[model samples]
Target: MTNVLVCIKRVPETSGQILLSQDGQSIDARHVGYTLSAHDECAVEQAIQIARSTDGEATVLTVGNDDSLEQIRNALAVGCTAAVLVEADTENFGPADVAAAIADAVRSRETDATTYDLILVGNDAADTGDFQVGVRLAYALGRPVLTGIGTVEVQDGTVVARGKGPEGTEVFELSLPAVIAVQEGGVEPRYPSIPGRMKAKRTPVDMVTASVSPVGNGRAALRLPPSQPSVVEVLGEGPAAATAVVDLLYKLGVAT
Candidate 1:
């Protein structure tokens, strides 16, 4: 049975307005909610599907502080059999630092004979938008890596990954023990059922200390794009508006 590992990240929920800190160094999440990246949600689902079909176990992992355990439990509620938490504050760490820590954890687990046959990661982080972790981790582990994959299936000791291209769907075949960076293809993530949630709440998560120190590059502060201005015009009032609407439609060639 193939063992699968899926990496998850806790980022500020992107469904609402995003606010930056005054220093512009990071996202101001004081009033915002937190959730896993959309692509990572697909990754988790993919891993679970693969493992379930093969009678294997699925492990969900994250590089963050104790608060990130919420995400781990969520993964468990869906289908992950277990979880690993690389305890640290990801707020101040960059992609390289996070990748190094994850690689360390993978090595540690392998040393204990908990080898993973497949690793899944999000194509990019929700908040930082960094896409280096999966590639870097694959490099560190000396494994084949694929990024921006939409669909994935394991068959006869090989993985078939598919992604959309400008022309059509592109497919790649790779052997076992490969790292794949997942994107939101056509796969829909599943929600936790009542029994699943209860089981997840009682599952124990393995927590470990950070093995790598965060190092700084020549990078500066983060910034957000300027908001677009909205324009509104008064057409008319009551029956008078019908004439204005008809004239506008005729001018736009929507009417003969």
Candidate 2:
């Protein structure tokens, strides 16, 4: 019997209207209503695929506040067995600190002598898009990691992963109890059907680490930038405009 644990993050929905902080650091999550991140959604879909393929159990684990329960239900609606939430609400909680907290959580599981065959995570959260957590956690866990993987499968304690290399597509076969980060496209994300949603709503979610001590604390103040002048606009005759545009693009190193 193989058990799979997927670690996911609730991230902000990037509506075009939203902008980053003025200092060019941190997001204005004030507008960031939580949602499953794109790559993390792919992680959930991959979990479902593996769970179906092997007929095993897959559980979702996340870190956030009460606002994150909806996202957990979203995961359950897709077909995950259950969910666990770790509330590590802090501002100073850098990637390393988050990784440490996850390591502590994994150790708690280890205390029971319970071990998962595979652990899945998004390559990065959309908000920070740091592309760090998966790798960081893997490092903390002292496990091998396959990063930027688009397609992945687990079979008998091994991971068969597809990633893009400089030349083209690269495939990896790594031993299990390992970590794998899902790429943007990867597998198709699943939506909880009406029935699935109903079941998920009825399903109970366990909240562990209720008062997770945050490693990073404090929100960086945020403000929008003053509107900038238009970068591009079309005008004048079509034929000459096309030629001029092409010439300008080439000159600007935009096109050849």
Candidate 3:
């Protein structure tokens, strides 16, 4: 059986305009909605699939405040068998801090004889676009890590991962007890059923205090790029616009 742990982050939904805080230190999330990153969602689904196939268990973990518990419960509702919440002031937590906290939690579980056979995370943070956590976590745990992986499978105590490379698809095999940073588009995450949500509500979450101090990422401030102005062009009118549309499509290389 292969036990898996999936780490996720609650990020602001990017469908709407993203604004920075007045101090420019962080995102202004007061008016924004939050959800799991696409990559993290896929990673959670992969962990669930792996656990189900191996008749093991999948656990979800996150380093954040109480608001993060909603995300943990969502993962549990879909399929994760267990959940962990590492309480910390995530506003000041950087990639290194998150990795350290996760490493500490993993070590704590190891001390209790709860060994995870595989760990999964998003290739990068959706909000910050930082790509260091998985690699740093692997280094801290002394485990091999693969990033930007799209698919993962376990066989013979090893993980076979496939991802897109510069030329095309590339595959790698790594020993068990490894870390994988997943990208989106590998698998579709399942929606939580009503019963699943109810069951998840009753599942207990293991709460742990972050052992590391918050160290902000070395960015002085954040700046948003200037918005591009929109332009609208009107073709002719009625059937007369058909020729213009065809010509425009051909000019844009959309038509032969």
Cα lDDT tens digits, model 2, 1-256, are: 5677888877767764676756755565676566778889998888888877887778888776677888888999999886877776734576766676677777787688767677889988776667788888888888999888999887877789998889999999999788889887778897679999998998888776733455563446555667799986664576767887787788899896
Instruction: TM-score each candidate.
Output: 0.90, 0.83, 0.92
Tell me how far candidate 1 lies from the true structure as C-alpha RMSD in angstroms: 2.6
Q: What local distance difference test score does each model get?
A: 0.90, 0.79, 0.93
What is the RMSD of candidate 2? Answer: 3.5
Residue-by-residue lDDT tens digits, candidate 1, 16-92:
77898898787877787799999999999999999999999999999988889889999999999999999887667
Residues forming the 10-long window of minimal summed lDDT in candidate 1: 210-219
lDDT sort, best first: 3, 1, 2
TM-score winner: 3
**Taking the tens digit of each residue's C-alpha lDDT, what string does model 3 give over 103-204?**
999999889989899999999978888999999999999999999999999987899999999999899999999999999978888999999899899999
Could you tell me how far off, in angstroms, the CA of residue 237 lies in candidate 3 after the best superposition? 6.5
Ranking by TM-score: 3, 1, 2
Best by lDDT: 3
Q: Candidate 3 deviates by what RMSD? A: 2.1
lDDT comparing candidate 3 with the true structure = 0.93
User: Model 3: runs farther than 4 Å from truth?
Assistant: 236-240, 246-256
Return the lDDT, model 2, position 136: 85
